[model samples]
Target: MKRERGHFSGSVAVIGGHDHVHALRRLCEEYPDIKWQAVVLPPDSTPCLFLHEDQSMPEGSFRIQNDINENTPTKVDIIGGPFSGIIYAVEELISQGGSDKARMALPSETLEDTPGLTYRTFWTWDHSTNWELSQIGQQEIGVFNPYGKPPGGFLRDYKRCVDFCSKNRIAAIVIYGFLRDSHGGVEAAKELCSYAKERGVRILPGIAIGSYGGVYWEGDNQYNLATWLRKNPQAAATLEKGVGFQICDLAFPLNFPRSDYTLSACPSAPETMAWMEEGVSWLCETFEIGGINIEAGDYGVCGCSRCVARRANEKEAARRRDVHGDYWSHTDMADNFPRLFNAARKARPDTWIYSEIQWDNLLDPVSLEAQRRLPVGGIYQHTTNRTYWKRISAELTKSYVEELPMQPNVLRCQFACQWNGDERTERYALNAPVFAEMAQLSYRTGMKGLTIWGEPSPWYATVELSYLAFARFSWDPSLQYEEFMSRDVAPLFGGMEAAEKFVIAANEIDANQRLPLERLEALQRVCLEHRTSGEVGRRWLSLEEIISRRIYMGE
Candidate 1:
């Protein structure tokens, strides 16, 4: 690792807004003559991707020009987690100025002179039930009521999810319930819990907190927690008293208004910590809630007082933005959980805690190798399978498990969901074997159990596939990531090869192994590519797409 960093001039230009360009830029400045650019390479060199990134191509890296020489790497097919990271770097690295349509449209130069690591990540988020992959934001089907509208829904839709979990061998089913806008649903929670218990799905029910839409509600905020508690009186009274342990999901809606959420709960700040402590105390002791999750991880918008107070402890903390920035972060909310837990523990003891990691600590390679042992009793890293951008690399989701910590008790392989982004598509988001591998890691990490996200069983075949895949993996991490994809898929989709291939291609595109991307791209260009092909491959792809409505940008 040191060699790689040193060889890359010991300057890593992290792009894609990971934290911000400042931190990376400072690193570049610290190391003289070390150039940094957005162009990144694979963890190890693979001929297929190497060919794609070949600089001899007329338009290289930034943007590929169609007019370029045919042999000149026409396209640098990206396959992995760092596409977003790399692109952000490239956008910043290039001398800012307008150029020819060709140049402007596509950065037509090699970043040879710019020597540093540029990492970006791209993947699909299957937000569908067993029916189809839907859309994001308002376009998403279950955005408002995924678990269902209760009585009828809790029984029907949730059962669909439970069935999927059983069928898939999902490690655990995570239903992030709690509408911040609505009175946090107790009746709904009770019913949902009842349904899960009946179906026998290992579940961890938590709240999206600031999410439903992740944002600081001024109307809600205006009440100044104290005021709100005063208004509510009951909920507030619950806070003044602290508990033993409390769990805070870094704040839901990582993408902010896009995810329709914001506001980070800093556990380190005095007031913030105190306030958070109150919430933790009330929830942990009163609500008897200690174990929880933060699928997206910690409260990263540290510009606030608590974060600033904690800043002095961190050597690099000074570099983070002082102004409020995006509310998303790979932050370990467990760090703050301690302060809150201390406050709570002061109130009560014997509290178990949990937090979820989103995107596997953003390629730190630490969590991938070993997890930081925080007060967080368990860390539910979201290994949700969404293989949307496999053209860059396949089996990327499985990368979450390898570097797991040796824990006493943790539900390490808490597989979130299977439906990648709303609906299922040819794009293989959650490869079965990835979950299997994660399950292995979880088992090894002394994980307590597994949990799949809510609402798995639905109309989509992908959901069925997800449930089946999860089931297989949770029990056997040794299972091959692509094991039985064809045979397995065939039986699910009325025994069609085209459908199997479509699914295979989706995973393969990102698997970035064995197959060439151009060939992969040609494999399932889109729903149309399969619309007429007689091969079972084309037909299956079309059927799944028709059900999902998702389009693959490239192989």
Candidate 2:
């Protein structure tokens, strides 16, 4: 059989539910030049795109099949088990031809694609004052006072984030900060959730169960859980008299005084457990979120007598691990996680409850058993250290088989930017290669999905390239970082040669932790030479200026 090239002729029709239809409309809007039409099936047969639900397609799976005849226009069929899959198919079509209004072409062959991991997610730390300061580069960003109103442009930025996640095939979005008590908090969250639902994305509110913060109530800060705990010292986790309490101290040695003193609640305390259950229930009742992410606060569980007894009962050491010194050994703090999970599930049976487990606790028998005890559908784990990918992957695979019979999804949190107190030079952390390898490893190890931490900034080429590579690799793990840069990254800069120079310059700057004056000038010259006056070109120029001031001048 001879194959013929198919051309899209502006006019297109869609068939599906309200959300699917809305997504098609958005796609049309994205390509304004494409003349889109709505029509019924059978009688109108004019090169129509069919959308239907198929339970067998599996979660996060979508199929695209094109039929072309000699005398008839090409008929495209998009079949998906979930609505998101259908949206993903449409996104793929837009990327191929719809974005360029000049001509939209489709191959005569059928194309079917499914996510390697079942639950690809993205975590947005939009609420943390520190995160906001780091991300927006503003000195006046307030601390995480959830009771206070959101700063200007918060909603706009949040919508942009949702749109970006939708375009990149992210299945879920986990948001942290100020959703419970900020201005229009509940209403705004519900609206955002509804918006994400239309795009086939799930929105989850981050709930810190271990520590007390704005997650609990809508009243004044003094009346909140954290303050309440401070007043009632008996509920606070007891640390050694002279030993300062900091979550980072549990994992690594630090000379800094404890900043979160009396902020964390004791896991063994019955009152604390009841308060956690009540808080989770309240959140479920207040927001229309798809799920809730339970975070293990800044510091690990308390070292009080009650917590010690619970740890001893579990046959686990209550002390911190030797190597990292950050996480406790066989600590019963994790035991309290199941109570929160159960409470969440009881409140909202259909909601997905995610437990953020520390990396060191993954292999611990106590932690694994605690995970099995919950109605957990997902496990959120992260590591800044890529060296543990192989071990992490293997351990997760084993746990999935021998331990968690529920086969809960494993969501790996990958960091794009690491901020180390000093905000000047820690803006961009280029880890494209590391992200690509982890994506591939996740597939090989039977993990469900991975979420990239931090947002992409347009002014930084390194950040943009890193995000682009990570998104591409997540969509298709078979594509290596080198291939991704050559195909996707290089073209943005005009050609392969320009891309090569840019990549080399980026790698050198990243490895040496500084940009030489000569290297900066050389890259600027290259960028100007091949500049097409496009978005990528503008960003490259912007980045050069930023590097010159930030790195060279020590701004």
Candidate 3:
């Protein structure tokens, strides 16, 4: 039964914890006409959202109840647990009724929903490519860029990203290069973490155990790894002669030129381990960070006598080769990261700790054995190796995943970044189907979440659709792709009619297939048709620019 528009009379009452109520209060500011009032006690007459306040409500679930009675004011009793779920419930209401002071129709229904994964997340580089900073000079395109600029616009961009994540119900964002002098360093990170916390988002700073600049990325701060390495040069990794991590890749030499950010300490060095322990401890102590994402440098392993001797047997048994065709020992990662994970766990017992596993093969004996020894609750992040995902996609199954460790895991893929050396068209291409595949795999395997590059703003149609796909499937992996595109995605563009037209042109551009002159004309026609002036209008324009650029490149 549908309650007619204007049936909502009384203000909506919100009952929950202080943090959730505060968040809801802030959310309601946007919908001024839909009155939302925070209440200490549940009201009998008005609509209420009982956020984690109802005893019968189970964990990771939300319930919405609406009864048909046209005569009485429309009342919706939404009961949900966790801050994100509460936000999601409100969003559902808005989508069902309307938003931005539009007439809302509350209908009769009972809907229950919950997220498929507990830890849906995104990965970003703070000092490099996540934002469009003013004049940073050659350092704005890659991770761990050394140059510094005022946090000004960069921080604002980060806040906007957090807002996007919060709206989409993404639980966390792992930010590398999170600490910098221009960004106010530790104080700034603490503040930003607090901001994310308010919106039910975790800002996990990327901590490199042996590289990527300690707790802080690049700064004169005492906690920086470079600062410690300067004093104890012997602690630095002794790389093989003429070998260093290279950032150059397909078209990246010119398009995304960047120096190697690897400046790692020897994992076996006692001084280095001690320094890392202290740095991680300091980071946990000083900030209110929700978690830590730690990694050993992805480049060459330390060639020091002690380091080489420790991995001799493990490296021999593991015949896996990296992109360079050199012996890349998972044993090296296995040996070093567990200690760091232990350090982080000891420092902050409650925070989530993610240990990076940089290869696609999860069945490798050396790495598999090491995974069992990791802290029980720690999350192992398995990153895809370039195009190896194609094979993984073909062969993946729940039975196969069961052969690996049972601890929580997250699938990390480099779809658009320079690391993606596959044939898939990068940059503006919409890889929603690929994201859907990953989400489904994660769900079937009982993995906690998945991570993708979150630097691109959603204004880019490809990136917008990517974010939408990730958010939609990550929450409910069972949702079909076509339904997601029509029901969830189309609303952003205006409606189904406009969205269908946009998809016809966008798909051609994304596949790198040559678009005939008619398609370009169609894109131009849509742009003109939807040029009413707003965010939706800007989306159409942004998409047009991408398609036009491809045409000009003749690719």
Candidate 4:
């Protein structure tokens, strides 16, 4: 079949394994008019894209070769490891545009690349930023629940998240408050898990071991932690009469004004351990989840006699080892998490078992011992407290990997979170440079994953660019930030010059810097000049609105 001088038409044959073929199939779904077929090898009768799974290729690696210009039907060969690489290749096929136009965009080049990390993840709170945000939505500090009619509305929002992650090559997304009645309960959650899996993304449901209402958050299920604790008050932690968490920290205090979930279960209680194990097992068996992110409630530590005794013992041991004082919940975690981790591992042996370590520095003897005792395959996650991250930024080294309990370690940071003040004032903050540095740091320290808050919709320019930077840099930390903005993200804003202007304005907005009225007007003019009539054009128009709003509101 001979194609036109500038455009290519007709069917595109996709040949690959089940997963690879499925990835291509989904990409083709949007183009209903285009005929696509699954075959064993490249067929000469039509244009073919062959995805060959090469076992020898290292993890997170892929190679693409295009024979489009030379061949009559136009051919492309994508050889790589599984899912991720396949997704990347097919995404590139449609990078310029989708459907028949995507075929025309195919370039004659040989490219090989690999992800810097094995697991690139995004974390979010389901009841908060994960859903859509609106002007009339609940403006409560951290809560932003923008749900529509019923099950369909909630599920659609989640599917959008999964779609965003899959397209960006993000391997996993951790959803806090995964089970909620308003969101269609267990059935909807199960459906989402299955859907994400098909798209090469994992949906990790966030579960608190002794708080946050267990596996079924807000569900009237037997395993709800709050329900279980209420029924068995003896298992509840005994804090002093008027004692509660103090709002000492600069950021966390603002995010959690009501930090008084002091009704935490006693870590040393036998009943608490049994209940956690049972609840976790039920959750794992019930849903087809990618994995569970278990946290031993960060609200407050149990002050019951048994718990106090355990903490005292841990403190003594920590002192003797000359690594004391920074225990801060590490003792509680060591007491409560082992059995829970084991139960999760037993239920889902092949899936990722994430242990959420609240503190970044695990220098305390109790935390170190706990790390040593945990299962090897577990993904030990360390939180990047703003203050802690700043202080320890220079101290990290490849040797830091040795401090971790497992090979695959992930760093979690906040983006667009109220407690995280970086982009709190204006959501349109350009955070690519921040994430690029994070990716390089994580990759250098032998960490396998880098996670940031992903509750914001990617449709927003800043959020989309932030997600793009996270995906690109985490996949290949070697990518230069400026080049990435120019080569990858610039196209959406018309070109590199326009993109730079957008980036500058966005970053200033994020920093809460005041822009002069004239500057705002100039930005609007730029947006009008280079705007296209497509999605790319829409992004520029969106920026124009933001600038227009700033000028009108005089903020």
Q: Best candidate per lDDT, number?
A: 3
Q: 1 or 4, which is superior by TM-score?
A: 4
Per-residue lDDT tens digits of candidate 4, residues 179-227?
8777788889889888887676878888776766677776567777667
Clashing residue pairs in candidate 2 are 247-299, 250-325, 250-326, 251-325, 251-326
lDDT of 2 by residue, 226-299 (tens): 66676666777664333323323122333434443226666677877777777777777766667777766534
Best candidate (score: TM-score)? 3
lDDT of 2 at 370: 48
Assess every candidate by TM-score: 0.46, 0.82, 0.86, 0.83
Clashing pairs in 4: 115-475, 116-475
Each model's lDDT comes to 0.36, 0.60, 0.69, 0.68
Assess candidate 2 and give its lDDT.
0.60
lDDT of 3 at 175: 87
- State in Å the error of residue 101, model 3: 3.1
Per-residue lDDT of candidate 1, residues 1-555 (tens digit): 111110222222322223233323433443345443433543222111111233342111233122224343323232111112222223333333133222222234433322111100011112333222232221232333323222233334344554444323232344443312232244444454444433323333343222222211212442134333333332211111111111121212222132112223333334444455565555444332323343322233434444444333332332223322223333334355445436546654533334545432222332321235445444444433233122112333333444444232333222233223322222334445554444555555444444444343333344445555555555444556555565455645454665555566555543443344456445545544555434444435534453343224332
**Candidate 1 structure lDDT:** 0.36
Give the lDDT of residue 59 in candidate 1.
18
Regions of candidate 2 where Cα sits further than 4 Å from its true position = 7-11, 39-45, 70-74, 98-103, 127-152, 178-180, 212-224, 227-236, 239-262, 313-323, 327-334, 346-350, 360-376, 380-416, 419-427, 551-555
Question: What 10-residue stretch in candidate 2 is worst by lDDT?
Answer: 243-252
